[model samples]
Target chain A: MPVIEVNQLHKRYRDQVAVHDVSFSVEEGEIFGVLGRNGAGKTTTVECIEGLRSPDGGSISVLGLHPARDRAELRRVLGIQLQASELPDKLRVAEAIELYASFYPSPADPRELLERWGLGAKRNTAFGNLSGGQKQRLSIALALVGNPRVAILDELTTGLDPQARRDAWESIEQIRRGGVTVVLVTHFMEEAERLCDRIAVIDAGRVVALDTPAGLVAGLIGGQRLRFRPSIPFEDAVLTQLAEVESVRRSGPHVEVTGGGDLLHAVTSALARHQVVPGDLRLEQATLDDAFVALTGPAAEN
Target chain B: MNETASATRTMARAPQRRAPRPFRALAVAETRLFLRDPVTVLLAIALPSVILAGLGAVPALREPADVFGGIRFVDYFAPSLLAINIAVLGLQNLPTGLATYREKGVLRRLSATPMNPSAVLVVQLVINLVTVAVGTVLMLAVAVYAFDVPAPRHPVGFVLTFLLGTSAVFAIGLVIAAVAPRARIAAGIGTVAFMLTQFFAGVYLPKYLLPEVVVRIGEFVPPGIGAFQGAWTGDGPAPLQLAAMAVIAVVATAVAARFFRWE
Candidate 1:
């Protein structure tokens, strides 16, 4: 059974509709990503799931409990790492573990959990003195220390350097291997692609698309995009004339052709017929980045 | 797509287990933090006592005076110093600590855990109470033993007044922590309140020197030194003074609980 089910969830503050018609379900033991740009209601959606925010409309069932009405029950089973949440600066690593552990009826063993998360040696280190990556790892450890059945981690790597981000991803994968379901909310496409089993793309407070990483990329227009600067400039129609080509557009100093089956071969053939050799020859397939843009659109970023 | 971002209210949710273990754990952690910074702890808990000792060192204050009703000036000032001790913690330390937690999202973070957000606050209160208790003891020892300021004649009344005064002033501190948007602002407001409490406690000038109306008015103010003095001299534990402390304690605590912000 799905561990979290959000249906037609809605929330607003004053007059601003923060989340409207949002819906998704997270299955047990999966890292489900809620992907979106800034202000897309990704955080709001997950906050509602975590029982931190009450929804204005629609029902949410998390582990068969209502998020708002059954909050205490939901809290026992659901762990949350809020975006920008912080610990007391002077709190030592081991002390933090002890404090957070006391919150649960049956918490994970602090010593083992610390060792597993690579914080065993740094047990005496204060939170303020930890490196960015260590802080992120500690946050994840705190989320799972409760032995919760499900954990919601929001923007976990927003500020970490690339290496730290990769390290955090490993920690998350390890958590998933331990049989805990995860709801990962993030804006970084690469993060979602690397860690999420399935992603729900939210745009302007609505779910634009929901699919696996590859599926999202594959499902985008024509499944492939070809970008090249012609050796000799030619009419945009040269590629547009092909049966497989759907849209022919120009990106400065190059032409972009997007289409379905056999698009790469068809475009190359058409370019050859025009006596034009492609410079900076690059055959582009879809990426989650491309999928995000196609789904959310460049205009949506503003 | 503007996010409807605002601070989340830490709503009281489902029945919580009446467990003392979590509270103890948090209290230990808070105590560790308190001790970790010795400068702040010493200044908050020991400064007033040191100031009292300094006053006792002055020869003029050591001599019994007419206005003091046969009590030494140092002895008259010592009990008010106790009130000042409570005032410092409530006005300066507690508000700054709680407001910093709120500003840094510590309270908000605790809300997400299985931990009730109120636990964070209660633990702080518990830890500060320990500090205040320790500070109270150390100051009294210095007053009675070090300075030979004879112990308060009505010890029970003195202790009761101390407790009530602590409640009243700390409630005011809580109100500062609750409404202050930033930690620095909380500190600023706390300092101003601390100064006012000092003025009323006659720390800057002896009551014999102050105007008659000012003395009467200071009796009604929080950490009311008049009440503390009345209890110490064995003549009066004025009912009206006790009532004022009780009223401030109940009203300010309720206001603080109602208006506190988690983030």
Candidate 2:
């Protein structure tokens, strides 16, 4: 059975609709990505699933239990790391972990979890005294301590440095390998592309596209792109004569060739034959970020 | 697989047995944090005690014999001091602390876990109650031994009045925390409210000494009526006024729950 099933979920705040008919299901042991710009209803949808906010319409089930109706049961099975959530200023890192663990029916040992997250050295430090990265790590450790069947993390690597972000990514992968399902909500394209098993791009409070990163990139805008700074200025007629040259565009000092299959050989052979070797010849593949921009247009601005 | 499943089940059931520990831990955590800051601890406990002691020292501060019926100023002011201490902890201290918690997103983190918002609030109230209890015991000890004030004629009545009055004021603090735009604004409002209650509610001076207009206005305020009639007195106020105070406490609590912002 799917670990989470959200069907036709709608949430309205006053006159504004925050989530409109959003429907998706997360498979067990899968890293499901909910990608969206700010105000795209990602947080609202997840909050509904976590039973923090009541949905105005439709239904949500986590681990075969209704979220709002079986809130306690849902809380028992699922853990959440909310965006911008905080602990009391005076609460120590170890105390915060212990405090959260006390709420669960079966929680990981606080000391063990802290040590595993490399927070043991700073365990005595008050939450307010910790640096931003340390705070984020502690928050993640709290979410994992419950040993929940499913973990929901919102904007996981938002404010972390590159090294810290990479460490967090490894930690998430470790959790997923331990048979825990993950639902990640993030606006960072690189984060989504690197960690997500399958991503649902949300736009204007709706799911605009959903697919694996490679599939989305492939489906949105064909295949490989051949870009080069042509050694000699070529006319449109010369570019069209090359095989596998589906489309060509000139911007400033370079020429961009877009197409599929054997394009590299065709372009290189054409260049050699004309004695026109490009200064910088590079092959570029369509990325998730490109697909996101293409599908949502400018409205998906993060 | 079956053995692993059984192990998982056992692990899951373990936490249920230890659920209450977290609530106690949280309360202890709050108490430690509250007492860690010397300034705040002083403001919470010593401020009311000092004010009460200072007021009791003045001979002319005593109420007329007709009103208090030969009661000493210390006897009259001691119970009110107890109530004032509770009010400060609940009405002023709690609101500001909760508002800062909300402002800093502390409560939001607690909410995301299995901890209910009500649980957090209960822990805070419990800590405040403990502090108030300690302050009351110390204040009463000084009143009896040093000031030679009479013991409460109706101890049960005094305790009930103190609990109800504190709950009412605490409820007001919760409402202010819930509705205030920011922590700084909540602190400002709490300070202003504290001063207003101290001045108008007869905690600092008897309502009879105030202008006729102020006395009339004091009748409508809960703290004023609570201090006047709920504290140790010859006969206390009418049963109807006590019932009104109880109702106010309940309604204020309900309103606070309605508007409470978890984030």
Top model by lDDT, which number?
Answer: 1
* Cα lDDT tens digits for candidate 1, A27-112: 99999999998999999999888888888998889999988788888888888888877788999999998789888877777666
**B20-51 per-residue lDDT for model 1 (tens digits):** 37777887788889899889789778977899
Per-residue lDDT, model 2, residue A167, is 84
Query: Can you tell me which runs of candidate 1 are displaced by over 4 Å?
Result: A226-257, A261-282, A299-302, B1-20
Where's the lowest-lDDT run of ten residues in candidate 1 chain A?
Answer: A293-302
* Candidate 2 lDDT over residue span B1-263, tens digit each: 99799768866765554544667777767777887776866767676567767876787754446555576666655654554676677777888888888887777777777777677778788788777777777777677666667565557766666666666778888888889968899888887777776665666676547787875665445553444344455565445545655787899889988998877
DockQ of each: 0.35, 0.49
The TM-score between candidate 2 and the true structure equals 0.85
**Residues A76-134 of candidate 2: C-alpha lDDT, one tens digit per residue:** 77889988877777888987888788778778777767877779999899998999889
Cα shift from native, residue B34, model 1 (Å): 1.1
**In the order shown, what is each candidate's alpha-carbon RMSD?**
7.8, 4.9
Tell me the deviation in Å of residue B35 in model 1: 1.2
Task: Determine which window of 10 residues in candidate 1 chain B has minimal summed lDDT.
Answer: B6-15
TM-score of each: 0.88, 0.85
